[model samples]
Target: MESIYIQTPLGIAKIEGDKQGIATLSLVEDVALSNEIPSCLQEAVSQLNEYFSGERNAFDLHLNPQGTDFQKKVWKSLEEIPFGKTRTYLEQAKILGDVKAIRAVAAANGKNPLWIVLPCHRVIGSDGSLTGYAGGLWRKKWLLEHENPMRQQSLF
Candidate 1:
């Protein structure tokens, strides 16, 4: 798999994938991946920039994130979450047809390698508070605020 790191207002992010699709996008404190940016990565970088700039609401990149079957199921569920909307882990578990698997569902969410593209940041605690996120709670909060800004919140 090929990888390239890009700088964003949130922080430096490491994007890794190949012709098949983008697999991961992890926030990093530094750009340590010393490699040429591939054409696929350029598209991702542009979309990510548009996302951060609030000019784009949805991503159009082909993604082939790596993970176990269960994790893939969870990530796919996450994709169904509408932009600017949030869902609880329990709700996601219920959608997966097993309310008892809440913990496992949350675990899969935590293990989601694709980050924003997979929309794991859209999941929240049952009480509507931000919860676990591999990219850090601050980034999660920022993303939520970015997606659902104060004006948007007021509409509801």
Candidate 2:
């Protein structure tokens, strides 16, 4: 296991991974330079930097997000969400052909560990409200506003 930290618009992120692929991305306010990053971490860090700078719309880095089968399903669905679009949990559940599993789908979404890399922030409340982002609702709001093409004035 190896880790590297980089500054992003949201904050500094510590990314960890091995040859298998990137495993964890933890957001922090500061970086600890005590650790040496593995060679494999460079590409992931570069790609993530591009993403935060708005130079990259989608991530191409090899990811090995670890989770349950249902969580994986939800994460994959999150990936399918376009760069600047939002989807409701109910809609996501219906897309999975299980409309009644809305709460389960939301739960799976909440457990998404890869954060912005997995695009879980694209999921919103059924009424188009931001809610339940592990990274915090403010970050979610910022992300949605960042991804919007029109850049509407925010009430926040």
Candidate 3:
């Protein structure tokens, strides 16, 4: 698999993938941006840039996240969550047809390898709270706000 590092508003992002598809993308600390982006990762780099800039609300790059069958199922379901929307872990479990699997669904989300592409940040706690996130709660909060920024109210 090919890999590249790029600077993002949040931090440095490490992306790994190949001609087949993008396998992983994650945030890392203290890493230099890649000097050159190979052809295989060019589209991903472009899409990621657009996403951070708010010009794009959805990802269109090929993805090949590595995971087990159950995890794959969970990830696929995550994709159904539209941009600018959030789902609680309990809601996700219910969507998966097993309301009792909230923790398991959250675990799978924690293990999601494709980062923003998988939209794991869209999941929250049942009480409208931000919960466990591999990228840290602050990053998760930033992403949630980024997707649906509140509009200012004006009074004349």
For this target, which candidate reaches the highest lDDT against the unseen true structure? 3
Quote each prediction's TM-score: 0.90, 0.90, 0.95
What lDDT tens digits, residue by residue, belong to model 1 across residues 1-156? 888887777778899988898988887774465457788788998899899899987899999987888889999999899888999999999999999999999999988888788899999999988898988899898888898855454554
Overall lDDT per candidate, in order of appearance: 0.87, 0.85, 0.93
Candidates ranked, most accurate by TM-score first:
3, 1, 2
Instruction: Say which prediction, candidate 2 or candidate 3, comes out ahead on lDDT.
Output: 3
- Candidate 3 wrong stretches, greater than 4 Å: 153-156
- Predicted structure with the largest TM-score when compared to the true one: 3
- Lowest summed lDDT over 10 consecutive residues: which window, candidate 3? 147-156
Q: Candidate 2: misplaced stretches above 4 Å?
A: 29-36, 152-156
RMSD of 2: 3.0
Number of clashes recorded per candidate? 0, 0, 0
Could you tell me which residue pairs clash in candidate 2? none
Model 3 residue 44 CA deviation (Å) reads 0.5
Q: How far off is residue 115 in model 2, in Å?
A: 1.1
